[model samples]
Target: MIRLRTVEGDPPDVDALVGMYADFEADDRAQGIPPIGTDLIRGWLTGLEGIHVVADHRGEPVGHAVLVPVDGETLELAIFVHPDYQGATIGTRTLGELLDCGAAADATAVELHVERSNDAAIALYRKYGFTAEETRSMELRMRRPLVTPPVA
Candidate 1:
């Protein structure tokens, strides 16, 4: 069974998460993420401040999703699932739960940039209501509204 847990303002098993990245092949990377080494991975992980959700399988973290604040009230989304764990519908569950997490935190909306050629990722985002707003440097910038407009 897969379990999703929120990691907000809390430290997670950084090593396991980083290891998942290391296991990814060159072709599996999106936007040059997961870095390359332990130090770079740790650096990237440490630099973010926002909501994180991890998918635990049995005892190890098999996937990760994060929502980092971009502009005030808007968050940028990113998700990575270990290569071995891909195609099991884990990405669907992880991202869906993260959106729930975002709504709980009162996020105005969530945005993500995915590789233009990554149809699978784009489809996943589209499945959750993210619309492609623009394309820049081979990446598609997508956004999904999470909160209602305040009474004006």
Candidate 2:
């Protein structure tokens, strides 16, 4: 069974999370992230600031999601699941939990950039209410409002 947990403040078990990213298939990377080398991945993960969630199976991280503050009311979102754990709803669950964390943080919106060629990721983001805001070269910028606008 997969269990989801929030990593509050300082990230815990970063080595384990790095291991998962290390094993991630290069072909699956989007927007040049989850950087290619161990040192790069470590640097990227450590520099991230905001809400974080980890999907663990038998105490090992198989998926990770984060919402980094972009501004006072918006956050940038990113999610990744290990290749071996893909297609098993790990991404779905991890995303849901991360969004919940975002809501708790009082963030009003979230945005992400995805490779245009990644149909599955685009579909998943759409399913969660992200709408295309712009298309830049080979990437699509998507955004979703976390708070409902008051009827005027």
Candidate 3:
């Protein structure tokens, strides 16, 4: 089972998050920039609500995700599953939880900038209902409508 929680900032899993992101960035050198250290990752996490969710198996962290709010109405999301857990649906579940939280907070939409070369992520986002609205350089801007509350 996949369990998710809204982590405010700097959870114990921050190290894991940083490691995965840094590794991914290293693997794709031209995709923006790689996180150099914990300090930078912490600084980035500090600016937003830092929604972090972990999927555990037998009390071990196997997958993790983070959603950084871009503004009042937009958010940037990233997820990483340990190579051992890559084929599972942890990423999908994490994305769903983030969207639910954003909708609950009255956000109208969420957006993410993903490198076009990252076909797996692009495909995953599209599977989760995100639409590619534009592209710049090697990055693609994807957007998804947040579920809105009914008019009172």
Q: Which candidate number would show the highest lDDT if scored against the true structure?
A: 2
Rank ordering of all candidates by lDDT, starting from the highest: 2, 1, 3
lDDT of each: 0.87, 0.88, 0.71
> Across residues 79-140, which tens digit of lDDT does each residue of candidate 3 receive?
76766677788878888887787777677888888888989889989988899999998899
Candidate 2, residues 92-131, lDDT tens digits: the string is 8888888888888899999999999989889999999999
lDDT of 1 by residue, 75-146 (tens): 999988898888978889989888998998888899999999989889989989999999897999999999
lDDT of 3 at 92: 82
**Candidate 1 lDDT (Cα, whole model)?**
0.87
Ten-residue region with minimum lDDT total, candidate 3? 25-34
Clashing pairs in 3: none
Better of 1 and 3 by lDDT: 1
Candidate 1 vs candidate 3: the TM-score winner is 1
